[model samples]
Target: MEPASHGLRESATFDRATIHAIQRAAETGIYDIRGWGAKRRLPHFDDLLLLGASMSRYPLEGYRERCDTDVVLGTRHAKHPLRLSTPVTIAGMSFGALSAQAKEALGRGASEAGTSTTTGDGGMTPEERGHSKHLVYQYLPSRYGMNPDDLRAADAIEVVLGQGAKPGGGGMLLGQKITERVAGMRTLPVGIDQRSACRHPDWTGPDDLAIKILELREITDWEKPIYVKVGATRTYYDVKLAVHAGADVVVVDGMQGGTAATQDVFIEHVGIPTLAALPQAVRALQELGVHREVQLIVSGGIRGGADMAKALALGADAVAIGTAALIALGDNHPKYDAEYRRLGSAAGYFDDYQDGRDPAGISTQDEELAARLDPVDAGRRLANFLRVMTMEAQTLARACGKAHLLHLEPEDLVALTIESAAMARVPLAGTNWIPGAGL
Candidate 1:
């Protein structure tokens, strides 16, 4: 009390976390690297509120009216485009970064929820494929575990150029998590650190990307949809280019997206937020006259039904979730609080997925740790979460007077902050002023 009265205050530029970071760096020459998405606050979906139908508008009855959530992706090309019952799909999280049981659980849950799950960086696993009704195989720059048979076996293919957490940067998998099985799947030496390439080896630009898309189509006999996934940087130009590159679906991942391992600096400063990126992608798609036709699947920091509804209102065909999915799978259960404490992290704060010491067994490859998670139970939990999220979205959509989830539009939203108003291109709350309109 005496110190406060005397005007003793901490500097905003050098806060407690900043001071600790500086000290940590001084002690160790190497920079700190950890798992998870950006920790810093940014303008996000939470800043936007849905406008419920009132005097001038009419909202649907929650109990009697129907709000359709079904979405058809990859309709632009492919013999069989996916028809999902819900617009919320599971995002890519690689086998190497997650246990086999975890991957299987994700597959089972997504299938049960009538949505698609993706095979991330390290290729397809039988556990995932056997359970998932619809799976998208990721064609990553690393080419880890890539196979023609797996490609053909998948329901669709995603050509990943970058992810949101570390745009223009490579991925990192610590040596500790790279066991014999992980090494075999990725064709890497056992117990050696793995680093993914930032760019594809064969392609340099969109022109080359077109050629690659053609090759992928030929490989699958054009039966599967080809998706081009990119981080949310230069999104407008990127979306336009992806369409021209013959992509049937475009996936934009924002900076808030999770990762297994990457530099802290990269996670915080590399990319734009999801709120800013979605509008740009939609604008680009609209300008090209393929907004709904091409299908835009957005990812990064998407959490609840409100976030889903907000994304839909801003013009996304669907939204994908990764971190929330893992959480639903019990990645940070309070039952493991003691174990988390031992790891110098709390149950809700554990994000060092690269350490291979997860108590919940969702992120580790260790035999004993991985055994702790029952795939069936975890799958059920995830399914429940997915169902709840869908219901929430439906509730919001109904309030917005939307007959279907896709019927949500920008006019139904208002931003809480000027930053959010600018980022989302929505009017500020209590006013009709958009922060950057006509600029």
Candidate 2:
């Protein structure tokens, strides 16, 4: 037998996946659309490390010390603000994108964990509202299922200007995921592709947004807090604008944030990373002298307690999770490995949430697939995850000699890479140099 011949290596710049994508696009004459966040890695929390106390700083005794994780959001101009027991909250994942059971599970889990859950593009669901103790209703460009009654029912309202997955682009719910119920909620034809408007139809700029906020406040009788959620791109300006628009809280979602469905190009190419966006958003708030008063919630690529702690250290009042929350609810459980494989993907690798064939039942619309998930069990799992995350964050806070998670500051952190140092605005490990500090 002839020995196997080695061919020339593929170009690192244009790898096999890139070549395949190009070929696919050429053949189909269409852009590749898929679910989830950026596939390419960027600077993230893993690149930063906590500088635990030893000689210079005092460390608290783990067993005897108390490390509070509570956070109050939307205090700037709200008559009633949301006081959460944990600094970690659930980010928005729309009803049309997530199964109703999944929505219920998210609400139950968030409520059980003493945090808050948010509505997404298709607006609020009764299942979610009924289960969530503190629910934040989203006002998106699509405005599907939006009503004054539901708005009044919410504990808070988040006016979503953009999402991290596709910053400038609108939302996409493929035809396959659009069931009759979803169609009814969105007031669209069943099995038809739905593209949410990129911008709000009624409002144009920040001034217009201020008026809308006032209108919402009036409609709700000034009872609910108003939050402005923006995709992280020009975050410094966007956050400033949101605050100026009378938002009680500002949520900045970075590129690593997930979506149920969007063009793959947008997810990979658009928006800034969470580590890069957080400091800018904080700076904007500080510039306006509303850093804490107009609370900031940072999202995107927040995986565990460490990420939450890092966000808090960087001056975010709280952190929000979407992909991580779904994972906690069993979106890609190893138990469903066989089913995932059958769908041309494997557990931990499935990203076809747009197709609505999720084996874990969290992202599907089919009755049998959706029925696979028990909301109670999923909620319990999510609650456990949240508890673990909170505990982990508290552990780090105590190590940094902080009595509360909010007391954690940038001084408690150091970056392992120049990119991370620049993005997180932290000093490099083994050096006092913070890239771009003097600039």
Candidate 3:
């Protein structure tokens, strides 16, 4: 017989973490608020594998063949669309949530990579704007730090309807992170927790959104591309609606997307996975006869070149990265392991970004900690990472006999799992069956 201790195992349904969370909630009388995205395992790009060229198709010579990775976004209605050398763009990280130095590093890196970086919730920063060659200004519900002059200054405008981390939910920046500068920019009281509005104050639905987009276009002189960003839920319908609203580009963010701070329940339970959302958004665009015309940018859980290739193969025009970008900028670095442990978290496991005590200095506003990160050095690291990701994506594209990354199709992929096959709309490996294709 097994030992009594061995026989008394933890319940998989009510695990240790779950039990602790329940206890914590009961004691605090409040839901847990944390940074980052869902930690639960979900079907992602990892479950899909690229089908390299063989007898049916010829392969491109890696040394000789040229695989174009360049992508142009927002050409549908904007006078000046972004012509990027690479398809990987940096997702938004707000000024309040990140140090100015970190924002500068992001700008430097994106500019070096010949891509764009976005201005998140708290509005544009001079450091970011100065360093970034192409900047996308995010217009959120809070209208924090909003100014018409800055709108005109930006290369593009992104109307954020939702985020992948907590769709249909507002964001929160704990009082600890709300410094005087942050308070001034957001027009909120210092040392007080702030919550962003879930919905746009002026817009109710698609009709109202259309007017808002028009207003933005008029404000920006139609020179900037207007991107409508929505969290991955009812993505097919949302994509269609965004297009109908005269958006030049549509950004669909998946559940794996990160956030500054939000309730753990909302982050884990609210949105759809990126893999599942991509196909729906693509289908909507195809059905509307604007698959490539409207330009689709997918975000959330995009880590490397393989992920980017998989997204493109599934019909995304480009990819956006957030958490991964922060890592490149020196977040969770092993060198900060001791500091992280002191904060009651370990390096690579730290998600308390809302605490404003990041040892890496990328996510906090503490002057001394922020100074620890050298923007130039961090920017170089990010640029290098971006370059590597682009190269890997190009290599995969070439392997699939594609002359351009954009030419990758669903046929170039095979799923390792039935769930992935169903979600990605790709066939299972060694089989012609797609689990839900018939339905």
- The residue pairs in collision within model 2 are none
Off by over 4 Å in 3: 1-7
**Candidate order, TM-score descending:** 1, 3, 2
Worst 10 residues of 2 by lDDT: 1-10
**Candidate 2 lDDT over residue span 1-439, tens digit each:** 3333555566899988899989999999999777879989899999999999999999998979899988888777777899999999999999889999999999999999999999998988889999999999999998998999999999999999999998889888998889999999899999998989999999999999999999999999888999999999999999999988999999999999999989898999999999999999999999999889999999999999999999999999999999999999998789999998998889889899999989888888998999988999999999999999999999999999999999999989999999999999999999999989989
* Backbone Cα, N, C clashes tallied per candidate: 0, 0, 0
TM-score of each: 0.98, 0.97, 0.98
**What C-alpha lDDT do the candidate models reach, one value each?**
0.94, 0.93, 0.94
lDDT tens digits, residue span 251-303, model 1: 99999999999889999999899999999999999999999999999999999
* Error of model 3, residue 418, in angstroms: 1.2
Q: Candidate 3, residue 155: CA error in Å? A: 0.4
